[model samples]
Target: MPDKDAGTPRVFLIRHGETEWTKSGQYTGRSDIPLTENGEKQVISSARLVVGPGKIINPSKITQLFISPRKRALRTYELLFDEAARHKFEGKVEITEDIREWDYGLYEGILPSEAKAGRKERGLDKGRPWNIWIDGCEEGESPKDIAGRLDRVIAKIREIQGPYMHGEKPVDVVIVAHGQILRAFARRWLGFEIGVKLPMMLEPGAVGVLSYEHHNVDEPAFLLGVNMAESEE
Candidate 1:
């Protein structure tokens, strides 16, 4: 059980389930895709295992749910919580652009290998490799832009949890978004800049927890490498 007296707040960052693009390792930004059949099965099992009573995500404790303004994310959110849980949530779902996937621009709908090959052909990868974090895409938003947008989302999270931070009621939020943006959001949640080489993997249908150490919001931290077996309890 969590320390209620410590005034801890948590955010459950969930990557949307696999899509055709995701299965093929294609960049899926701004292209609104649906989940594959396997992806739906995977999310159903995961949701039952990790989001019920005493689970990693307790539906009753969730205050707000932010979903990416994409069908993939909205569908994932739908599958993760059952009708009962959704009713308990009382219409807290808000589809926002803030949590959308990184704008891959010219690289959209292509694989990373293809992007690299194209850059290499243009002699753009001559130096230190084409890093999306630093170099960005030819027509995409920069790392700085991602940082700024996510910072606002984090600020809203803090504001939402503020009233419950004094040990009154535990507050929890959920974000259903894409892989790259959620991973970057996790890094920013811990006060780190986006990286050219992403530091972590947030697999499709995976759930990650971000919270403050010792209930101090100033000491934000990621619950790294959490074991799902233990979370099942």
Candidate 2:
């Protein structure tokens, strides 16, 4: 039987596993990088944590699984539910381009430090952010772009939530995408201003859950949690 939690379609947003480019601090906007071995382990662990019945999340409770077309995200999706057990993350894996990493444009595949130093030498980093982590995006993407895409992907998820929503919507939705999308998704959906200036990072295979009380476009949606990663030691 499917489990119902407080009568709402809880969404679990996760960042993909680590890649060679990610380890070097390069901007991986739209780049398809495969996960490291450690990344696979991390995905399995996080899956147990969130999708198990012992926690607030359950796999069967997850009606849909949306993934980024990138290799890292696709790998995470496969590792989490490779065999598809009844009690585990057994769901359809769908791909959404809107839920992709921030498009760095000309800056993709370059290290953050190198970009900053070069931009600084060229006086482009002045009044510009160093890392996308705390300072926000500079050469890659604007807040409007982030906000716009987040809005679209989230709206798409909300529409899918109508059928499997249990007593809430239609069904529960679980999205496996990138860090930038996860951060923006949580911020916009939860309506939190605490970390607006900071770009959020997720451990490869980390999970962030965003829940809401029905829908009220005027007021804040409500933030359930963020940056929950796997302890694959």
Candidate 3:
């Protein structure tokens, strides 16, 4: 039987598994890096234990799947769902640039320390500090730009949720993407402004849930560190 968590709708935010750059603390924006062997194994385990017939994400409950255009996110998505469950999924899986990692621009392929040092050398920091949310990247997106892009996506997700929240049908959505973007999405999901430091940290291969507090769409909230033990119906 197809499982359904009727009433409140949810948007599951998944961070892709580890990559070479991720392990080395390098900025990996728009880079097409594949996951490491351990990363693959971790996600495979996550799929088996966290997403299945009677798991945190019931295959029958998914209404839509959003993925970043990057290879890591795509691989994570593939690993998060088994072949049979993927075949059984009736939702639309869309690869959107909107959910891609924040373009690191001049900071790409470099560590934060290197970028900050470079900025200091160039007198860009003005003797203070460099915050991506405030100062942004040299050639990449500002916080406001990211907010604008994600807000549009959020609006579309809300459109999908309207019917589900109103008792029309069950709708659960999933997003597989990078760490920074997923955190930003969660903050924006609750209508909060993006800050220099995000309120939460999303570890590699971690999953977070965003939904209404008590079945009211107006009161969106984040279910921090959602584990399979607490989510199973």
The CA lDDT of each predicted structure is 0.84, 0.66, 0.82
In model 1, what is the error at residue 45, expressed in angstroms?
1.0
Residues 1-233, candidate 3: write the lDDT tens digits: 52333357889888999999989999999889999998887788777777876577876778889899999999999899877867766448888999999999999999999999999888887866888877779989888988998998898888888667745565788999999888888878878887745567887887788887656677777765454543433
Which regions of candidate 3 fall more than 4 Å away from where they truly are?
1-6, 166-168, 225-233
Give me the displacement of residue 87 in model 2, in angstroms: 13
Instruction: lDDT winner between 1 and 3, please give it.
Output: 1
Least lDDT summed over 10 consecutive residues: which range in candidate 3?
Answer: 224-233
Q: What's the lDDT for residue 141 in model 1?
A: 82
Give one digit per residue, the lDDT tens place, for model 1 in 1-233: 96443446779999989899999999999998999998888788889888877777878778889899899898898899998888888778878999999999989999999999988888897768888877778688888999999999999998988666665675789999999899889889988878735478888898888877766777788876454533221
**What lDDT does model 1 reach?**
0.84
TM-score of each: 0.91, 0.75, 0.91
Model 3: residue 106 alpha-carbon error in angstroms: 0.2
For model 2, residues 84-163, the per-residue Cα lDDT tens digits are 54335444656777778887765688876776777677776466466554444555676666777778867776667645
For model 2, the run of ten residues with the poorest summed lDDT: 224-233
Candidate 1 or 2, higher TM-score? 1
Give Cα distance to truth, residue 65, candidate 2, Å: 2.3
